[model samples]
Target: MATSTFRVNVLLKEGVLDVQGKAIESSLPELGVSSISNVRVGKLIEFSFDHEGSSLTDEEQTKLTKVCHELFSNPVIESYTLTEVK
Candidate 1:
């Protein structure tokens, strides 16, 4: 078995209010970062999995997706993307 690394990117869905993101965005102007806008806060979760191959199998991906949905992110307000890390 090989150990593979993956990343789960969790972010608030569009139309959902991101209070922390808004707070940081509002403060950026005072800190001289005025050109950036539409800032949103999200979390990156890295995990390792031991599997048979270099890439994740379908079953492994399903398991990870389930974990992301059930543990790492909120279904109503957040969306997530899973990627293999090199």
Candidate 2:
């Protein structure tokens, strides 16, 4: 079996109103930081898979997407991207 590492980025969709992101952004000026705008807060998740002498295929990708939607992200307001890291 081969072990592979993957990364998942989960973010709220555009215009979804990230409350945490907004609060942090609003506080930036008080922290003496200006010139920054449109801040976003998202999540990064790293995980691995062990496959039996086979590379990841489309079916595995689909399963990963399903896991993202079902467990890691809120499908109504957030979206996610997956990448296999070298």
Candidate 3:
């Protein structure tokens, strides 16, 4: 069996208030950083799975999607993207 690596990016949806992002943005000027706007904080999760064959199968795709929805992110306020790492 080979191991496949995946990266999951989880972030708050548009129109949702990102309080932590706001706080960091507010403090940037004081930290001598300027001209940065629209700051948003998010999570990056990298994981690997053991499987057969060269690439992920349809079932693996579905399972990863389900995991993203059920575990890594909140379906109501957050969105996630999954990508295979080569």
How far residue 70's Cα lies from its native spot in candidate 1, in Å, is 0.4
lDDT of 1 at 2: 98
Q: Which stretches of model 3 miss by more than 4 angstroms? A: none
By descending TM-score, how would the candidates be arranged? 3, 1, 2
**lDDT score for residue 76 of model 2:** 94
* Regions of candidate 1 where Cα sits further than 4 Å from its true position: none
Please give, for residues 1-86, the per-residue lDDT of candidate 2 as tens digits.
78899899999999898998889888998989998888889999999877666687787767888889999899899989988889
Q: How does residue 14 of candidate 1 score in lDDT?
A: 99
- Deviation in angstroms for 83 in model 1? 0.3
Spell out the clash pairs found in candidate 2: none
- Name the candidate that leads on TM-score: 3
The digit string of per-residue lDDT tens for model 3 on 1-86 reads: 78988899999999999999999999999989998999999999999988778887899778888999999999899999898888
Ranking, lDDT, top scorer first: 3, 1, 2
RMSD of each: 1.2, 1.4, 0.9
Task: State TM-scores per candidate.
Answer: 0.91, 0.88, 0.93
